[model samples]
Target: MGKAAIRIGTAMAALALAATGAPAVAGPQDAGGRAAPKTVAPLMGPRGVDALGHGRTLVTETGGTFSLVVERKHKPARVVPLGNLPTDFPPAISKGPHGTIYLLTGASGPPPEQRPSVLRGAAAPAPATTLFKWKRGWPAPKVVADISAYQKTDPDPWDQEGFPADSNPFGVLALDDGTVLVSDAAGNDLLRVWPKKGRIRTVARLMPRTVPVPAGLPDVPPPMGPLPPAGTPIVSEAVATSVTVGADGYWYVGELRGFPATPGTSQVWRIRPGSTNATCDPAHPRKGACKRYADGFTSITDLAAGPKGIYVLELSKKSWFAFEMGLPGAEEGGLFLVRDRGAMPRVRELAAGRLKNPGGVDVSDHVYVAGPLFGPGALLRLR
Candidate 1:
């Protein structure tokens, strides 16, 4: 059977297995929310026939340093310094085909500007580089992407309005074919760049500045009375905190809503190739787009797609939750696996212990999650 067919079949079987109450092959859970030890096949990297094989994991630290960890030992294999990264650098790293590592670094401190907006592009040289030559360690990555390329092709008001260009880039994914996708939370857009080909494109622009809320949804409290003066812009701050491209070539976006706000919400959006752009009101240039794939989650910080479905990593009041994606009908879709944190104990255990503020996730036969923490970020291996 074809790969897609096999994935579908496996998904159906997993669903049936759940319905039959068949015990999971391995239960990696114990009291106090820790994962119990169980013997399982070690994760392997992709081989000749397998498209999704487990392999070595690499993680980047906040200071632009990287550490490689082998799966079997789960110990640090090597540590290297990434050049051109700033002291305030916040790094996002991903492994391209054949173990080439791509690192994305954000601008250090806030620019000398005051605006309730996220950064869009990097003013300084983006701290991006490729390491690991294939013959020796991994293939050295080529400079195949630039965030500014989109500004040149399709200019948006955010570009002109001083939306922080080098906002935090929290996620990175390398396609098997060398296409690199980076999610800039500050810019609220998914950037696609082909360094090898010197091509740049904005695969999708999100939350155009005209998204509307329900009418009569009191802009202010009764005591406060009238809303802020007319012409006051309503900045959505719909930051794309994390992103992952599926084997089928669809891009999944996770929005971290309301940074620096009390009681923040989160959302998940799926954008397929050739999707249409929603109309933006010329009069209200700062409003966000009306068309959206899905919404309504509380602080979805990371996302991953596997044979089962899209897995969402949610942060609520410093707590974490896992949501499975489901396409309900023609009107976008909704999230499932709600409030069932135990269903994915691996994620739950990570959240409970090491994974604070997780920003990226990728799943194949085994799951790999990355996030920012003290002492060089962590790459958790879930098998």
Candidate 2:
């Protein structure tokens, strides 16, 4: 799978199985009614989350299920299973305008070789990566866009692969006018999909990121090859993972820098609404329709914008590569709020070292993060 397999929900099970001696804890829950954080729902491999008003939240799991989490002040939270997708890695979901809900599925394929053989050739009944739409009282979600078909016709221009036809729709943002924006982690581009017309188009292409190989890296073993010496400049894929509309109305997208997965190398880019063919290159950030918003993040898996600011979710504090390798100091994830502070963007850690492999985040009355990311996770309410 190499670069194509560096997706969020792909190798989680294998990585978990390999790290047998790692500690198993839910991390710390915060302290008061207004200042404490608590788990609102118990889920397995929770990957996507979005807030629905009146103490309701929509969460998706890597196991292909999605549910509505309802919380009451005096009672325990209730998780109501709504429906399940055909693909296992339904990584993203969002509540759009007028109570409409949009769900996105990641790349579909056989299970990783490390997993059980029974799961490898399991039959999939639908397209690999698709956009689905649903609303209250709907029996099931309706297919709104065929993302994989679109990629077949229009491949990634800057893909490092010999065959550029890869599409993993990881992030989704539903607009007020019924248009949705999707970030393809494998395609390395932002796409615009019109639900009403069943049309999809490339909105922008994320440029490659140059990450410096950090020192003291662990040695590789077996099927994985050896790495170069430290200080090598590795040109990594942008791995466009999440998208959101800012409070200021600009479109913000975040990246999970590929390969080597250097810590603090991931970035968030700001693009003008309705931009076409824009570039999100960190090198020439301010020169195009897409510009750098805030950076110095490690393995950003999701981005959610609210009145406060853009909430960024990092899968691991050290980096995704380190976490995949089960390195020390990589198990604890982080949540941050990025907002404009005078002339610069200020990133403040909301739950520093308090989350374990958190993958999804959203802001409603307060910030919410979904965790353990790989297996048996929960939806946490942060204050």
Among these predictions, the greatest TM-score belongs to 2
lDDT per residue for candidate 2 within 1-383, as digits (tens), equals: 11433445656557753544342234454321234357787787788898876789999876567789999888999998877666667789987888788898677434544333333222334576889887877767778888989988988777765657888888898898789999988888899998888899888898887778877678878566587788898788888889999999999998888888888888999999999888887878887889898889988889998898898988887888887776887887878888888548888887565787887888888778887776677788875
Off by over 4 Å in 2: 1-7, 17-36, 108-124
Query: Backbone collision count in every prediction?
Result: 22, 1
User: lDDT of each prediction vs. the true structure?
Assistant: 0.42, 0.78
- List the candidate 1 regions with Cα displacement exceeding 4 Å: 1-55, 73-90, 108-142, 152-155, 158-168, 208-234, 259-264, 274-294, 315-355, 371-377
Candidate 1 lDDT tens digits, 128-226: 221111112432223445554444455443432354443444556676788777665556667666756656566655553332222222244464345
Alpha-carbon TM-score of each model against the true structure: 0.56, 0.90
Q: How many Å off is the CA of 372 in candidate 2?
A: 1.4
